[model samples]
Target: MSDSQLISDFFSRDVLLGDRALKAAVADRGEEALRLFIPEQEGYGASGLQIEQRLAKLAASIGANAVDYLIRVIRNGSWQSMLSAAPAFAGLREHKQRATEGLVDVLKQGEIDSQRLAIEALGYLGADDLAFCISEFAENGEWIPQRDHRRQPSRYHLDKFYFYVAQALIRMTASLTSVNAISRCLRQFRDFLPICDEVLGQNRISGWDVRFVQHNFPSRAADPLVRDWIASDSHFLQDCGVEALGHLRLSRTSAFLLSVLEDPRFNDSVRKTAGISLSEFADAGAAAKLAERLNSASDSPGFSWAFASLYAHDVAWPACDEFVEELLGQENNDSEISAHMIYSLACRGDTRAERSFSALNSQHLHMRGTGAIACARFNPESAREALFGRDEEANNPMELACILAAQVHAGHVEKVDSLHQALTTFGELPFLRPIWKREVLYAFFVAEGSDSERGRLWCEAALETPRRVVTEMQALLKRRAREVSANRLPRSQAELASAASRESQEVKDKFDVFISHASEDKINLAEPLYHALVAAGVTVWFDKTELKLGDGLRRKIDEGLARCRYGIVILSPSFLAKQWPQNELGALMARETVSGVKAILPIWHDLSVEELLRQAPMLADRLACRSSEEMSSIVAKILDVLKD
Candidate 1:
């Protein structure tokens, strides 16, 4: 058949040989066959979803083998084709050098949508050198507001090219600190702030990007500008300032934030935000001042004092007790404040608050819950008694959850079991509030013991719970598991080094280490460690380093795992929840069992020994290190382990 006939036959649903014909066409005609599906034309006769899926599958099949053809599709095909081809290009790790060159070409020449796809692909491929390329596009790109003739105020839209480019840069820099790529890009686009502000005022930008700036770019040169925004009449600007100040934690701004809090002239939102920001400061004076304000104020200004008290506790200010006492003395009888005071006292292990155990029967259910929690810390028996005596029929889920949490704290395993039975029995009742279900799940999570086999059984049950409950329970379990791991004795230096040597001798591998981590942790903890390992002359097989354009991601990762002498499992909340990392860890464990050699190195990040035990009991006894230690020190220690 002629090429046209072949193309026609391939897209024809009636043709049994369509898949075969298309494969042959792609192999023979390359770009020509791919281009047919590029535009929204009659010849390319598939629904949008069908077209996208078909194109994605075809691109994956061709992969690195047809890098040139894929590049042509990106360069010459219609917008639709470019979008479909971008993922293929990103996945082509074997041909990364060529694929990146092609993507950069498309980035320079393609339309806004095409540019966005290219930018995203490049980011996925870890092309950090192209940071300038992305920043340049963002700087030069125009704002194209969507036009609507029917509407009076036309909705504003940024050139999505610039927006995606900024997004991509943030992703790339998230895991890396040496580059400071995000700050650099922000500086380059500093002149565009007015335009950005205008667009932001119209709510054109996503809340994610705004939060990203407030979180990641704090203490930058632009912070002064952000501070100026606090004084602006615009609520958006004020919100941004409050968020930035909280993250920045600049002690210099404590006085200003306190002023904002004390000034009744300001709106409640801004004043409340200032109160939150003031808590971020480690200054004891700030905490004292806030306590004084709480004491003198006629009415409770929402939960500002509660926030301030919590912050004081977090910083471990010596004056926290004084602040808590001041708050307790206040005539304001807000349940929220009372609960917070009880919680603060509980966290501090202060038995002086035992006098307030009677509040466990308070009319306010939340206060009762808080009181139970406080009682559990100082007197577990009292807490258990208080909880058991409560009228079960009248109690809400929050109250029940608090009671169960207190039971967990008191180590009343039998009571916890009874509560779980009650929750499971009536959990799905139509009349029960959704919050009750969530609280029950949380109670189970907190109550479960790290060392207990029953805890594992409960977690398995929690997994089978409702979607929301399951998600919350899983997170809680993971967090508790990390805590367990953290409290355990870490492996000794000599032992770690000995294990690394033995694994190296056994595997005879090309790479010294394989980093298995969750994508969510890539920016904050995983990538930095990956880079640090590489810098320390460790032949690390990290995804960002080893995976190139047009390569099969899973296949490459598997190969790295097989060839590497040792594997580093960076355990975090994100890592525990991700299936891929868990799968990789499972494989690593299998290898260790098969070879009868120690191979996996667990690196704890914000987790405990109990939390680790909940997930991997086998690993609980094994020596591990923490991400909280100095990065360089951690690297040096790992290198010691790697060295023969």
Candidate 2:
């Protein structure tokens, strides 16, 4: 009956009757329910009609995901309410052209959330006309000003605003023919970089969300501005600026980053960020300098982070013997940083570290845990000793399960019994057991044993574990079954044959063509090629359309490559220019070399023959076509090869 009552009902989880009634009322009565409760929010002074209009605006926004409600409100609400709710309407692409005036009014208000939503809606609808509006906002206006403490935006409003900004940025980037529009917005916020840097230095944001500033940084944001940021008195700004620059992969920023790394004034996190930035910039000298900094025992933590960066990007950051000895000798160090040190040293697969890990019979649970994980990569025997619960003293079920999985990975038959026992004993701990349980069991089967009894038990247990855990269990069990029949470890000849057999079966099951294309050129060629193929009596597996469920995209692509009659790639100007496309082409070329399966059929779109020949000489030598009709013709050739 009132807003207070409604708010109270919203929060009261236990009041089932009231919650049900409120939800039902919202569903059934819609605007009528709000009119009746007008006194609650705005008091007796607010008229019923005005209350209805306001409630409709709030409803349209807050429950914007309810497409039906959004459509109804956009079509029926007053012009002002419709305008305020236009973004939600545009998301559904259900608004009439008349609603554009209403949307403009809301856009003019320059409320960050509204503007973001409007921009997002425009993008969702692919309304090219909104380009001018987005540019105007980027140039002349600001994101809704950060809310003051007393006048803070609601959480819903803030979330909506952030979501809109992310979507808008993506859309605006798409709208620009060149990087100029994106560059302009970034330059406008160039003044904020120091503030961003300062915030980062203070660790104002967590590592995961640091990408917010990083993603928004312009390609040219790495100018002398970064040097100014590092030299500034504000440590916070300098830290964040370095991290942002690293993420932007600005090689030009590496010299400046290296200089900062040499300075003792910069904190460990700042130095680490700079080191990683240097690696990204591909400054081999910077990597060597960072490695040199790791020469001392005290520099271990900084070195570990830098080492991780270098390792990821395939950079040559040598691990010094002194550092390796210091790390192996660090049994008494109790900080979480010690775990990082252990991980780094273990990553090197130094026989000394391996020996030290094996020799450690009674290490701290945490150290053993880290060592177990690290040793899994190389010496699974040491990993098992440090991790498996084979002895009564090695009774960390969590560590045991993990190490057992590692042992299985290393194909250590000796550790199979220990892995089985650990899984049975520790599989009840949701945090520890659920994930590694299946992996350890898979390893058990891989260790040359027919534990049909254990396999049956796990199969039953898998059905009851959470859905997230079940799929992994099923995959592991099926793999184990094939392994058992074939009588070989995962890496053995028999296992390889089984894998080939399974892959060949899957290929026969799908029997569709895999079309690979760069996302940027999706609109111009990839999208049409997929449609034309589907229209031309070919089953199509276009990633954007068929790979709608997000997880395992790369795996799906690989599977398709193995199974498909052919792989049709649209090679355009932007496609060849991008690293990801190059990677796909390289993979296809590698596959062809090994299998002699001419699966990849290239289609050249708008590229000169010479340009194609020069950029991708190997691909240019293959059968390719220039148009959709030509693409269809090439498909017949592919079918002929598959048939043969």
Candidate 3:
């Protein structure tokens, strides 16, 4: 076949023999076949989703085979061409020296746009040693925004360089010192790169990139800055700020968001932003807090917003269960503001929404679209008619992609033409791209198991998603690969039931936490810790509370030990020296040996790991929360564990 014909075959779905068709084509037709993808020749009309898939495929398949050609592409091609070719080195991480050298050479000599794309690829390559050198290169560089034929500037400006620098730095070195270093670097170089409109605190430093950084790599260092953003006068900034804090999902951040919902000064939009972000805190305390706010005479819709956020992520909490009846009582819930209540209850599997959903789904386009999305998530197969009924009615590409994804999420798919249509439309959605990518991936994986040609291609395509997402998909792929290798699970219901019958065992959890401590330390540690846990909405079994006058003390203590979800052992000098506490510790350890569940949560009070190692070596190995930390902080940590 001619070279153009070989390149033409790259876009042909009928030729999906395997993941490495590009590498195979290279073996047969030489390096010329790679040009179809590397520079991404024009006129094929590849959509956004297909382009991403091609990039990901090249990254996974090209490996070290095309390292020299890719390097030449970087050295000789335009910055846009360099950007197009960069994903290939991601596949070459194991053989990154040649790619890194080429990319770094671009960082030094190539244009600013080239430098930005190169540093990003370097971070992907895990090249940390070159950070300081790269820092020097960016120190004095000023951005001149890319322009169109009409001479209008692009969406992002020159200061975006700083944001990219910080992202690369964090990916290379994820330490507090590194975070602090980058924070200062931004301050020193850009003096707080504002949002150009998004404002980093010092002003608009084109912080759009920085926000993406915070979302993926949240740290305590950004806590104060994020708070200020939430407090800002601009509702837009406040929305961005609240979203950033939500990403952190710490107890203190949750507390701050609750305060925002409580405060009357903030506008409805800002309050609503605060409420939606609270979905990140899927803990009992957060849900209970929202429920408490609702039980009051207040009229904030933020509480329901928080609930739907949790439900959308597939998390359901008992704390939100009590509000379903109250949610049903709300009027005009089909309206945009109150729509969250509909999603919150529906996704939680509440039957009350059945009538409301039917009405909503049959309403006008806007309400029907909302209804279809919520219903699809609640019951995908049932939502089929609504999704497609509205699918052809809508003209928007983004809406089309969303409907396609909703259909996939609901366990339905389309013919090749529809799948290709989904591929084209998904590119229009930049932020929602990853989610839609997973939807396409799931659709493919279901139609063709991981061993099939299309399945391997889709898996390779998904590897070039965001770093955190890539890590998650890699773990899932590894696990699925292992399961495929063994293929030992029972196939029939009878076989599965027999296997399950052999392993049938159940344990009831009466308390969220059980505090075990010596009476000598009760006044200082145990009693205070007990009150704190209770205040944080955790059910605890303290001997003082659970041990009644007529109770069998030893038997009751044993019951508390076995029934609690987690055992908080207050390990101190007194606790370690006591015989009773040691016996209790032995019981918890025995439970682990039998069931293989790590249930012990240790709090070191006036005790060192070294001393504990001498007395009880087994307990010493488990990391303990230091008593010196604030009691609330300790309670927050325990709540975090319960959340997981």
Error of 1 at 73 (Å): 12
Residue 465 alpha-carbon offset, candidate 2, angstroms: 28
Residue-wise C-alpha lDDT for candidate 3, range 1-644, written one tens digit per residue: 55455555554432253224555666775555556566632324333334534554566555676777766666676655666665445456667687787777776677766677777666555465566545444444532222221222233433546556656654443322232343343232232223223322344433365554443333433433342344446565566567656654444355567777767787787677677667544344455555555544135647665654433322234454555455444445434323445544444445654643563444334344445445654554456655655566656554454455455445454432355444433433333323234444444433333334553444444332222222222321222223334652222212212322223245688899889899998988889999988988999999999999999988999999989988899899888667688668667754543333457899999987677655544355466798899998999889999998
Model 2: residues >4 Å from true position, as ranges?
A: 1-106, 109-179, 192-209, 212-238, 244-260, 263-269, 276-301, 308-319, 327-341, 355-369, 382-408, 411-644
In model 1, where do residues sit more than 4 Å from their true spots?
Answer: 1-166, 179-182, 188-192, 199-203, 206-208, 212-307, 310-338, 350-375, 385-407, 412-644
The C-alpha lDDT values of all candidates are: 0.54, 0.47, 0.54
lDDT of 2 at 351: 44
Number of clashes recorded per candidate: 28, 7, 11
The sequence of per-residue lDDT tens digits that candidate 1 reaches over residues 1-644 is: 58677756555432224556667777776756655544422234333222333454555566666677766665665665566565444345556688788777876677766667777666545465666556555544532222221222112323455566555544343233232343454433343334554544555455456554333332332233333455556665566566555544443344456666666766787776666555434334344445555544323343344342343232324434565565665424666556656655544445656744877767777577666766654455566666665536335755675566566555565566666544433322222222223344444444442233333333333322232333322321232223235642122212212222332233458999899898987898889998888777888888987889999978988889999989999988778767678768767765653343457888898888877645443355556789899999888878888886
* Candidate 1: worst-modelled 10 consecutive residues by lDDT: 146-155
RMSD of every prediction: 17.0, 14.5, 13.7
TM-score of each: 0.38, 0.38, 0.53
* Candidate 2 positional error at 389, Å: 5.8
